[model samples]
Structures are given as structure tokens and as C-alpha cells.
Target: MTGTAKGMIGFDWAYCRALAVGVQDGIADEDVERWLPEARKVHERILKERESGLLAFWDIIEDEKVEERVLEIAEHFKGRLVDNIVVLGIGGSALGAQALFDALVSPFYNLTTRPRFFVLDNIDPLTFSQFLDMVDLGRTVFVVISKSGTTAETLSQFLIVKERVVSLLGREALKKHFVVVTDPDKGVLRSWVRESGVLSCDIPPGLGGRFSVLSAVGLVPAALLGLDIRELREGARAMAALCETASVIENPAYCNGLYHVIADLDKGKNIHVYWAYSDSLYSFADWLRQLIAESLGKKVGEKLYGPTPVKARGVTDQHSQLQLYREGPNNKIITFIGVKSWPADVDIPPAEEESLADAGYLGGKKMGELFHAEQRATAWALAEAGRPNITLWFPQVTPYTIGQAFFLYELQTVFMGYLYGVNPFDQPGVELSKKMTYGLMGRKGFEEFVRYL
Candidate 1:
């Protein structure tokens, strides 16, 4: 938190020491503060360049049209009897939606105020086939998302869904059962929207898939959940404003980014674990896995960079991975996420009988209390064992707070990209693997890439 802590979320690095991480392992405020000037310089340049309209994600927080379009599209099918929302996307296209769905939606949404939601991000044959067999096409709407509109796995899923819809409900069902979120100007999906009259929304041009969840890619799903999508963006806009502040040390985004880089480069910690105590929050870590790994895991002038991102849930991972974190390779900086309050809680209830006396200590306590108690204990254990860790506290889980968390980490990752001297916007390594897949799948122009094999 350094000097810029926001109420939407509280950053506690107390065990990261008084100002967050202490001089443990030779790291302290002095170590991280020294990078502030460089951070300030980077921010000034990026902010100036951002005005040139180069960073689409940064601008989305203020773009009302994107939200308008998403809500408009959501109502088209949402007004009907739609029962399921199956997102056909992969990587960036899928992770953001998954994060939002898991974080903001109820664990039992299908049993309550909404429809069942699924993200078909992978093309594993068995999983894909089983998913298709599981949902009713008549009551389902397939949301196809691909910024380029030519993503292989997504397009394949779309084709199969479209064919099934066409066979069951005829070609007329296409407009009602399918909606596409893709490039506005040009792409296969764009052209399809025009020619086929399928409902569609534009993902702002130049908005990389990873950073696009704030755009149509995420809002489309948020809209489906009947969430206050505007409030979500408002949270993001607020965080963006904080990240844009003049002083780098006063901004959580910059300070957090600088320290992680400090840990990786100066302390030789190459793994960063995002361990969340809430099950609903596990998806954000999954999303971060892609965001940090894909954005910073780059080769710059022959040196491979970036801390490997690992996702863990407290209590579950407390039993599973905490041992390694405490005694394994002392090469990780774990970031623990905890909720300040549970939206709803259940009492532990006194043990049924004396036979269950071993659990009597928790009789009157709320489950959330126990949940966070374990989280607190885990952080203390790690820090005590000399494993550096940080915590992000959510006052409560809501669309607005969820938005703030997304922007916080996304901006932090981008700032870390600058400190590492790489273009966070591009992923040439992922692109190479994509081309190889296209070649092996028999795409026309990718024939040459297959030769590399």
C-alpha cells in the first residue's frame, strides 16, 4: 500500500512488515523506495503516451459506449428464457470472464437469481463433448469471444454450436442463441456480424485479450448476471486514477510492481504465489496466472524474465502447498488474498455431542472467522519461516470491489513489464505457439510454421 491505499480494497503487507515487507531477506522500504523515481519516470511517459490512445484497456474505464453496448446485447437474449451462458473462448478471452463469474456471481447462482454459466476455454475432446451433451441448446446462448475473431479453438467451438443450433432450431435461431464479441472494424466475426445479422459487440481495437475483461469480453458476462456493470467500471476507473497519480511510491500499482521486481531480481525469488482464502476468489488467481505469465514471462535480449505465477487457495493449499512454501525452495513471494467480511455466513454450531468435543472450540464462531483465521495463521507461518508474502484484503466481495482488484493487479503487472524493459502488450512467444497450432491444424498460410517442427 505504501502511501496509496484505497478503501475498496486494503493492502496489508504488515507481515510483508510495517510498510509491507521488512528488511527480511535484505529487502525493506529503502530497497523498494529506491525504485520510485524510475517508477515515476515510467508512469509519466506511459500516461503521456496513453493519451495518444495506444492503451485501449486504460481507456475502457471511461468508455460508456462499451458498457452501453454490452447491456444492450445482454438484454436481447437475457430478456428471454435463456437458461445457460456458455462462453466459447480461450486464454485472455476466457480467463477474465471466468474471474468475474467466479468472484462476483454466487456459488449457487443457478439455484438462485441467475442462469447457469460455463466457460468452454479448452478444446479437450472429452470435456468439450461432455459439456455440449450436458446443456440444452434451446435454452442456452453461446457467447463467442476472440479479439482477432480468428482464434482456432474458439472458432471451432462456435462452428459446432452454430451447426447444432441450426439443426435444432433452424438458421433463424442463430440471432437469438448466439452473440459474438470481437473486433469492431475487421475480423471473421466482424464480417459475420454484418452478413449474418448475429448480435454482436466490439472489443475495442488494440485491446489485447488479457487486458480486455474490462471491455465487452467481461461485461457481456456481467450483464448476463444482472450486475451493475457501471459500478464495476467505476471501481476500475477509480483504481486507474490512483495508478495514474504523480507520485509512484504513493500508488499501490507502482509500489507493488516495483517490490515484486525487486524480489525477483535483487532477492532471486522467481516464483510468485497468489494464494486467496475465498473459494469465490480462486478464479482471480487463475486469471492472474495467465496475465502475469503471459505478460511478463518474456525473453529480453536473450535473458528470460518474470516470476513464475502459481495459484493457491488457503486452507486447501494450507494443507497441500504451505509445507513447500515454508521449507522447499525459498524462491517464492506469496501474495495472500482475504475477504474482510463475508457477505453471508453460517454458524459453526456446537458439536452434536461430547464425542465431537475436539471441535468444541469453534462452536459459536462463524465459518468466515474460521476461514480467515486459517488464512492469518498461514501467512504468519510463511513469514515466520522466512518466506516473504503479502496480503490483499477485500472489504467485501461485490462487483465494484472485484473490479478494483482486477485493475489493481492488471496495472501492477503492466508496470512490472516496464521495470523489466519489455512490451507488456505483446506476446510473441504465445503467438509462435499459436502459429504452430494453426500449421498443425492445416491452416493455409501457416504451412511454413509446420516446417519448423
Candidate 2:
């Protein structure tokens, strides 16, 4: 019983108006309008580069055969070789799959669905030991993802799993139990795949791990979970097509990023807080955090660019963080994500006790009504307190809307980078740490990095 089939997600900026939040807190159209020229240029650059192998994320579905192959592979694996699926990866490798699983799959998917899913994204020893005790080697298959094929956390875990599997079931088990997503031509994983004859997928070269969610990095795990990877592609494709223009007035990503640019440069709002109102969306919010922090938070020579990103859940964070957001420094901009229509709901029965009238006010209402009310109240309260905020609405959490969201935020981060005069793609700051870890682990060539540690 949805009101109407608007079928698209949208935003509400009324709370961000000067009339609502005051002149100092709210932004006029002119504030963002001044930033539009540069936004359009960035938009143009994205559109131009989307097909040129520079922005591979935009052209994720450019080849129809890619989905065809993904579906074929998914069909072969879902009902056949898989009864329990495990993903061995971290950061963008693991987060995209986790987000998609949490959002699109049932909350009790392991108990109800054919394949029980798990993502071992960390290296906690007890956690790994417990996971091994829980899974059946004969029925479980692993999706190992690493573009470079040598991520320390992921590779070490893979080594441990390999030894356990080999000792229990012999080396033959490796071919049947493991599937890899990595570089096509280079890296230790690629070489291992060629030698061991393991089933594998190629992560596109130009796409970084953070932006690789749309490629095989995300698609393989999605296929394993029996999700509609095609619909996900369609959603992203639709958003990408809609955002092909150079006008920030017409493009949602450019328009949204422009608002933030103005907030950062003109209003000194350096903290971007995202309040996701649903549990399913929390992982996506985390994905956005890494995307923003890694892509936009860079220093070239002497100047650092990019705002700090903060994430919170709706009613839960309201108790813990809302007080600070409401009364603390006015240097943060907040975005709330709300679901316009929920897939399920329960009606609250009328109160049995006469004196429990305080609680009885919520009787006979849909449970979602309270959830929606809390979000509405939070927005109202934030606005009244002159804290600038906006809501990004999802008609429902589907593969399409989720895809649209990932693309939107990725594009927005890119726009922020262009406006801030920084390269949003590479993360040079993270490389030194990787080198130091390798040296500390006694890898052959990185010994000099040990001194820094």
C-alpha cells in the first residue's frame, strides 16, 4: 500500500533553507550557484572520462556480455557448488558485498536461505577459528578478492584457510573451494590462479578498490548471494545516464556535491554527518565514509583537502550523538536517509491498561509510523536549532536504489575532489603504511620501511 509509484529516490532541502534554519546556517541558491561553473566542468570531465577507461565505475555495465557471464556464473554456483559462501577480503573488497547482503538479503538469510553467507573481513584469530569450526568444507566456497593479490590481511587469512583445507581434504579441495577476484595480468594472486587453476574474475585495472564495487569486486559476491546483479547494474546505469549533463541544476550528484562544496568553502561546514535511518543502510553509510575520507581527504604538497565524514543511525544515534549535533559547534552538515515505503510492518494493538495512556498514544499505529515520526522529529529539531540538514529518500531498498546510491556518492566524492583541486582517485597516504607493514612482516624487499616503524 504505497501512496504512488514515484519509482525514484529524491531529496528534501527545505530544512536547509534560510527561512527554516536562519541565514547563517541555511544556504541561498546563490551560494551553490557560484560553485556551479566548476561543478559543471567536473561533471563534463566525468562524462568525458566515463568511457575512456579513466572512470570505469561509470561504464560498469557498458558491456552487455559482462552481465550475461555474471548471471551464467551465478546460476552455476548458487544451487550447485555452494551451500555456504564466505568472502575473504577487506575494505572496499568486503564492504560492498556486506552492504549489498545486509540491504538486499533477508536479515535471517542464513537460517532461511539456501546458502548461508559470511564475510571474514578481519584477521581476528578466534573469529577465524570459530568460522572454520562452523562451516562445512565440502559445501563451502570462498570468494577471495584483492586487486593486487597481496593484501596482507586478506592474503594471510587466505594462507591459513588454505592450510586448514589442505590438511583436512587435501590440496584438491583448493580448486573446488576457492574463487578469486583480482588483477587480470599481474600480482601474486593472478600468478597463483594461473598455476593452481582456480576459478577467478578480473578487477578492472583503472578502478581503485574503493570504486571497484560496481565491477567484479562486488558482482561475484552478489552472484553468490543470488541477488539480481543485472538490476543493480541497471540502477547504476540509469543514474549514470541521468547524470550525464554538465549542469549542476539538472544532475543530482553534481547538485548534491555543489551544496556541500558551498557549505565547506563558504560556510566553513567541514564535518559531513550522514544519519541513516534504517539498519540495512548503515553499511552503505560506512562505504560512503571510506569513499569520502580516502578519495577527498588528500594533501598535495602543503594543502590538505576534503571534509571529515561522520555516520550515525537514526533513533539510536539520536540518543548518543544527536545532543552533540544539536548543541555543539555549528560546523557540520547532516544528511538523513529515509525509506519512503517499508517492505514490512506490524500494527501496534491498543493498550490494555487504562493508566498506560502515555504509551497508548502509539497504539493502532503502524510500527513504521513511529520510526518515520522519529526521523521527521529529528529533522524538525535540527532545523529549529539552526543546524543545516537534508534527507535522501529511498522509495524502497531494492537493487536499483542501492545501485543508484553507490554511484551517486562516488560521483559526489569525485565532484568534491575536482572542486577542492585534488585527485580523488589515488590514495598515496595509505601506501607508506602498507610498505611498513610488509617490512615488519619480514617481506624481502621492503626492509628499509622497518626503520620508520
Candidate 3:
């Protein structure tokens, strides 16, 4: 097939090279490449396995039924005169979409135009109270998203907001006020939706919450905020095409994944520093942090290693963290993310002779030139310190670049998961805290906790 056709069909050669390099580095087995030709067979096996129901779930996500349901939710809100949308969700359900919303949408989109969007993903009482106090209940809509529909933080906030909506708009207004996006067949959320008469949408089965950004969990809020959902899909589709290929060197995802594997397996670099030059991408770092942490953190045989630690801090980190990074243990792989051209730039003219003499530096260098020089110096210093680094330079910061960047990381992460020999799609570790919190809450049933002073 032609490249475009093959890309559309999800064939990626670069990702295959990534898988191979990962294997050769002893991070995971080389058999991953052998499984490529039988990719469909492997997918079928995943669909049949009980634990692999996630595969079947994701398969149905692109189905007409799911898309139609998402559109319905969008239409329902669009039909109403809602002025605000408060999304109550936590962790995966909230973070990815929130990051995209914040990055891609104009700050003025909500304030001057359509329904303003606010995310209440935290259980902070003060923040929740402030949010409610600011929004007008008469024109506000609440979108409660929990893949399982029973997340305590979500449900608790939902209950609080529901009571307020009922009080201000009355019980009859509950239908107009609340909507749910969750698992269709299972979970207490479905039962609650049925009993409460709130509109509901399904969270696809195989797609884990973290990976559900392309699904309704993400798209619904995105659409509400006037984002181009098609572009988002096209970007993901493009990345998927990149992931399914055979040649590794040509794929950005494979190269990134291979570098990570080599850093961890060969160089014993366990920490991955994601250094972004933009302040806007700080949250993007957090999203990457979760993606890496949850995907490769499983115990394999006697070894319990996860994907290398992914930390997202700004270029400003050079002033502080750069010291330890340069002089400390050689256990980190620094990835520098830079934009080739910033939409905003300030040029500093040549300093006056007196000022130049006082500073003991060049008299005529522009401020931009000085900043670039400093960045180059830091990069050189790190290299001199024997610190391996990779630089991803973006042409500019736009939706297209952002989309491509997101997909690049996602593809690399998936390959990294495969290389680590762990189920990157599922996060069994997150349940521990949820279970603990529920046990402590004494809600509905279960054991009581004793508090010692």
C-alpha cells in the first residue's frame, strides 16, 4: 500500500524499530516485532481474554453508537441556554482533557463567547465553594465524568452540586442541570443515573480512563469549549498510523521509545526529565508523568522497574535543579522540549557602554541572543557532564504542533510499555488509594477505622 493509504490503515515502520531497539537493549524481549504481522491475531486474543476486555471496550469506542451518544450530549447542552460547564472528574478522567482544554482553547473563548468551562477535579472544599459561588445556577450545566461512575471524589462533588442545583433551580431542574459520562452496563453510576433521571453517556470498555481522551470523556468537554474534535481525531489517527509501521528509524515514536529504553537498560538512567521551555506546557508534563508512571510500573519476575521517572519542570529549572542534574548521580535522561519560534518574543538592544563595562560582558548583544546563548551553554554543560539529552524542537506552538507533540508522546509511551513487558493500557496501582480512601470514609458499608491520638 502507498504511504498515505498505509498510514490511514495504521501501518508504522518507525514504531517497529523502536520495539526492536527496546528489545535489543534488554529492556524487554525482541519477540515484540514478531508479533507485528499477527497484530490482528494478538488483538483478537486480547478481546477474548477476560482481563483483556479493555481491548473490546476500546474497539467499540469509535462505533457509531458511542459517537452518536456523545453528539447527543453535546446537542442537549447546546440546545439549552447554558453559560457555564463545570466538569467534575479526577485523575485520568480530568487531567488529560483539562490539559488539552487549557492549552488549545483561547482564554477568551469561554469568557466572551460560549459556555465557560471550569474543571473541579480536586476535592478541595474551598475551591468547590468558590466555583459555585461565582457561577449562575440558572444558566450553568454540570458534566460529571467518571469512567466507572462511582469515583468517590466525583460522586461526592456531584452530590454537593446536585443538592445546590436542586435548591436553586428546584428538583425539577435536576434533569436540565446534570449529565453523566460513564460505563454503560456496570458501576453504581449507571444505577444512580437511572434513579436520578440524569442524562448518561457510555465510557468505552477497553479504553482505560487515562487513554480515554479521544473518547467522549475528553471530546465532550472539548466540543463544548468550541474545539475542533475532528482535528483531534485526525492527529490521533496520524499517530496511530505512525505506531503500526515496520521500520523503526523513520518513526519518531520508536526513536523516542528506544532512547528511553537505552537510557534505562544500558545506561542505568532511571529518571526521565521532561524539560519544556514553555510555561503553558507545564501541565502537559503532569500528563506525561502519569502516562509513564502507570504504564511501566508493573513487577516482572524478580525485577520491579517502571518506565523511567518522568518529571516535568520548566527551563527555569536550570537555575535550581540543573545543579544536581549536572553534578549529582548519572541516573537521568534529560529531554529538552523547545519551540523553534515563540509567538511572543522580546528583543533586547545592545547594552550601553557603561552598563556593558559594569557587567563585564559583550556591549552589543541582544537580550534574545543572550538568552539563547545561556540555553546553549547549559545544554553544553549537561553534555560535558556525561548527561545524555534529546531535544524536540517544535516549529511553533499551534494546535497542529500541540496535537503532533501529544501523539508523539503517546506513541512513545505505548512502545515504552511494550518494551517494559507490562500492560501499559491498564493502571492497577491507582486503585490502592481509592480503596483506602473508601475504607476510611465509612460510606455505605465495610470496616470502620480506628483513629489513635
Q: TM-score winner among the candidates?
A: 2
**Cα RMSD, model 3:** 5.9
By lDDT, the better pick of 1 and 3 is 1
lDDT of 3 by residue, 102-163 (tens): 66765566668768888888998898888878889889888889988788999999888888
The reply for model 1, stretches above 4 Å from the true place, is 1-7, 17-26, 111-114
Backbone clashes in model 1 = 5
Clashing pairs in 2: none
Model 1 scores worst on lDDT over the 10 consecutive residues at 17-26
RMSD in order of candidates: 2.0, 2.2, 5.9
Residues 1-453, candidate 2: write the lDDT tens digits: 111225566778778767788878788877776776777677677767765668867666666766776666676665575688889999989998888998897788889876888999999999998988888888888899998888999998888888888899898878888888998899888998999898888887877889888888888889878788888888887777777777676777877888787777788889999999998899888888889999999898898788999999988999999999999999989999999788899999998797887788888999899999999999999999999998899999999989888888888888888889999998998999999999999999999999985
- Tell me which of candidates 2 and 3 scores higher on TM-score: 2
Off by over 4 Å in 2: 1-5
lDDT of each: 0.84, 0.84, 0.67
Against the true structure, candidate 2 reaches a TM-score of 0.96
- Cα lDDT, model 3, residue 256: 62
